[model samples]
Target: MLSRIGLRSFRAVRNPVRCLTTKTTITDHTTGRVITLTDPNRPEIADYPNPKPELAQNKDPYAKYDDPQNRRNLNDPVNIDDDLYDMWSPDYYQFVSDKTALKHNAIFFSLVFGFGAIIWYFQLNPEKPAMPRSYPFGGLAKELGSGNAEDDEFYRVKPDTTAEQELGFLDGDKDISSAKESYIQQNADFIKA
Candidate 1:
């Protein structure tokens, strides 16, 4: 409490929080000095700033190509002079050609690999023994004589109905053969069972 008010009689503090803050004091052999300082790095505002005039009274010249208010039409064909031909170094064209050649080589290799994969899939798989296959109707598909789609539909035997489908049969939507097959199987005298 005694150290807080020992340095200064009064402080110009706008906030009550700062007024309560105690300044640190340093003591040396020569004499004790109490330093009261603000932040040294605080920036001063730049002098002679352009004052913004009112929207109605403002008069500024329109910047030609960059005026956003009235932009030049993009579709207009007006050729500007080639002032920036030397924008890049002389060797830049060679570097661009090298990059283009690399890109074309990469595309060509990718196409070669893609064509190789397609050829392997179509021609090579048939020669291999264990090619993947699904027999939906029990390899009976090969027994069809003509192998045409029309004859296969007519001649193909009906696949057995699953128990779950027969159990879940709600109404007339159930297969007409389900009841007939069940009746023949239950009457055991017809077959050699």
Candidate 2:
């Protein structure tokens, strides 16, 4: 003997969720009709009329020839006519040649002037005698066996004093005082007395 068993519940399961695979149909805004073709997955296929044979092989007005081998060769020499060269007069060549000669003459004159100026300058002031510059401050001190301060003091001279007084002043001679006193005395009579 076999026993029969019954299901406790018979609830139907919900359909499984699917992603959207088909795009929405596009429509013209003015005409308000579907502008795009219907889905291809449909059982009935729509027939598309073929385009005219003459219009099918129509070329673009802006399209250029597509032959890459017909490109210009840069290595080829330029073509010039002998008649074009003959059009120029002989005087034109002479003018260009004369202009070149003038430029050469100008350059030659400039070089000659520069050399003359250098020679004249050397002749006016020879290299041997450059006024015999006095020794520098401390240099003169070493030469004279004195301090730079003493050498500087010796060189400074008053306009009224004579060269003899200046020499005596530098030598530190006692005669300098007597000489100054006598000179002052000689000039004293001429001074509004």
Candidate 3:
């Protein structure tokens, strides 16, 4: 039965206790209409019609394309020579400013790159010590030496010539030497006399 009558009337019937409410009244400026906001559920519209200005009947149809202030006209005489002396003109000033900006930027980058190169060179190419440095492992070599100056001299020298011939170890027939051969003899019978 409540569903058939609708929910809004059912709500008023169920709640008999009445509560006093307030209404706000405002006037529309453009249309000069009085508006009363009696219910919170209903939306209030503030929009009004904005009509365009009526154009002059006898005026040119292309007059809309003219500058807003109508300062420049098509019939006005222009001098070509006067443009050269127009130093304060926006276009001329912009070109000159752009050229100067480019020059300054180039100078700044060149100085930066030059300073960076100088710093890089000093960092990479460090000054050498007046006296040459001794071998780091020379102490170990000296301690293990058998007191042979010529043998120990190899470790102390800058470029060690520790090849076989330099150490008096010949190329052929290692068995001929008094010392034992370094390599094992795989086929002693196949050895050439």
Query: For each predicted model, how many residue pairs clash, with residues at least 3 apart or on different chains?
Result: 0, 0, 0
Error of 2 at 14 (Å): 88
Q: Rank order by TM-score, top first? A: 2, 3, 1
lDDT winner between 1 and 3, please give it.
3
Tens-digit lDDT string for candidate 1 (1-193) = 5456643433313211221123332222122333332322221211222233222112243534343342333443322221222222122232458789899999999999999999887875554363233334533544755377667766565444453244443454356578767887898797775
- Which window of ten consecutive residues has the lowest lDDT sum in model 2? 6-15
The 0-to-1 C-alpha lDDT of every candidate, in the order given, reads 0.43, 0.42, 0.47
lDDT of 3 by residue, 9-109 (tens): 66655754332233444554434455555433432421222223222222354565344333334544433333333332334322458789899999999
TM, every model:
0.16, 0.19, 0.16
Best by TM-score: 2
Scanning candidate 1 in windows of ten residues, the lowest lDDT window is 12-21
Error of 1 at 88 (Å): 33
RMSD of each: 25.5, 26.6, 27.1
Q: Report the C-alpha displacement of residue 138, candidate 1, in angstroms.
A: 40
